[model samples]
Structures are given as C-alpha cells and as structure tokens.
Target: MPLHHYLIVAAALFCTGLAIAITKRHFIGILLGIELMLNAVNINLVAFSRHDPEKLSGQLFALFVIVVAAAEVTVALAIILRVYGRYNTVDPDEVNDLKK
Candidate 1:
C-alpha cells in the first residue's frame, strides 16, 4: 500500500533472487533467478508509477524491460541449448571449455 511497503517487498524479492542466483548450479536455474530479479524490478517500477499520476514513464519503462527480458531469454535459451548439445549438460561448472 505504502511506498515503504513496496520498497520492502522489492528488497525481499531482490534478496531471494540473489540467493538463488548465487546457489544455483544449472544454467536454467540461474535464468530463473534472473527472471525473479526482473519481476522484482517491474514491481518497483509499477509501484512508483502509481504515485505519479501525471506521467507514465515508469510504466513505460517497465514495459520496455519486459520486452527486453523476453528477447534476452529467447537468445539466452538458444545459446544454452547449443551449449548443451555440445556438452550434454547444463551445469555451469561442467561447461569449462574456456578454463585455463
């Protein structure tokens, strides 16, 4: 309801997303974490948009973010699929061909 409440929710979502990204081993799991973080950002954007009745910039920005996130996921998944085809696994640690 209040701005502080929205901020707290955003913080909690960000923390959860961060924890997931840090602990996940699989590529898809990490993508899910990123999606969570993106959703948190969207929530914050919309919350701020509600406070500003004159301009809709925050809402517009959130829309652009959603579009960009969709494109990113599409490209990222394609790359992951190719990597899996080569490595036979999606584990981040297992795909170490670039390791020195």
Candidate 2:
C-alpha cells in the first residue's frame, strides 16, 4: 500500500540475490541470483512509476530492463550449456581454464 513497503521488499530481495550470487558455486545458481536482483529492481521501478501518473519513464525503463534480462538469460543459458558440454561440469570454480 505504501512506497516504503515496496522499497523494503525490494531491498530484501536484492540482498538475498546478492548473497545467493556470492555463496553459490554453480553457474545456474548464480544466474538465478542475478535474475532475482533484476526482479527486485523492476519492483522498485514499478513502485516509483506508480506515484507519477504524468510520466511513465520508470515503467518504461522497467520494461526495457525486462527485455534486457530476457536476452541476458537466453545468452547466459546458451553459454552455460556450451560450457557444460565442453567441461562436463557446471561448477564455475572447477573450470579454471577455458581451453581444452
């Protein structure tokens, strides 16, 4: 109902995402964390845009962010799949070198 409430939720989601990104060893897990952070950002943008009816810049930016995130996930998943095929592992720490 209030902006602060949204802000708090976004902050929590961002913090959780950051923690996940830092603690996860798997590439897919890290990607999930990044996606969570992006969603949190979108929440903030939408919440702010709700306050301003004259301009929809925040909402527009959020939409752009969604598109970017979608593209990012697509590219990332493709790369991850390739890496797994080549390395036979999804753990980033295990893949010290890109060369075979």
Candidate 3:
C-alpha cells in the first residue's frame, strides 16, 4: 500500500479512537478506546518501518508500545475492578471519590 494510504488509515483509526475515548462513559469502554488509539499508533509505526527498510527503529518502538499498552491494560483493569467493587458501577460520572 501507498504511504498516504497507510497514513490515512492511521489517522482514521486515531480519530475514531479519540471520539470513543471522549464519548464513552464506562471505564472499560474508555480502556478499549485507549487500546484502539494505541493500535493506530502501532499501525503507523509498522507502516513507516515497511517504507524505510534500512532502519528498524519504528518496529522496535512499536513493539515497546505494545508491551507498554499490555502492562497499562493489566494495571488499569485491576484498578477498574477495585473501583467497581467499591462503587458497583464503572460510569465516569458516578465516580466521586476524589470530589472532596
């Protein structure tokens, strides 16, 4: 595929992910949106790597991003589980623990 095509796909995925993150009210939904955004970034990195075969930095960074995202999801889900246990809901508006 062309570079522009890859970039456009990446841009679309990023925009959709942003919209989901902004509009979703549930904690898990927000997490899914974040994963989507991260995947979009990975797509871009891989596409760039393919276009420039001389350097593997983009692919390396993409791998790092995937590892980080996995760790983030693990921790975030744990926290979300605790929050749900405490509040019985995952809606962002329902979380008032820090309202003081």
Top lDDT hit: 2
Candidates' C-alpha lDDT: 0.89, 0.95, 0.92
Over the stretch 40-87, how does candidate 3's per-residue lDDT look in tens digits? Answer: 999999999999999999999999999999999999999999888888
| Segments of candidate 1 deviating more than 4 angstroms | 98-100
TM-score for each model: 0.93, 0.97, 0.95
Q: State the lDDT of candidate 1 residue by residue for 1-100, as single tens digits.
A: 7887997898899889988989999989899889889989988998899888688988999999899999989999999998888888899898888633
Per candidate, the number of residue pairs that clash is: 0, 0, 0
Which of the two, 2 or 3, has more TM-score? 2
Write candidate 2's Cα lDDT for 1-100 as tens digits. 8899999999999999999999999999999999999999999999999877778998999999999999999999999999999999999998999689
In terms of TM-score, the best-performing candidate is 2
What's model 2's overall lDDT? 0.95
How many clashing pairs does model 2 include?
0
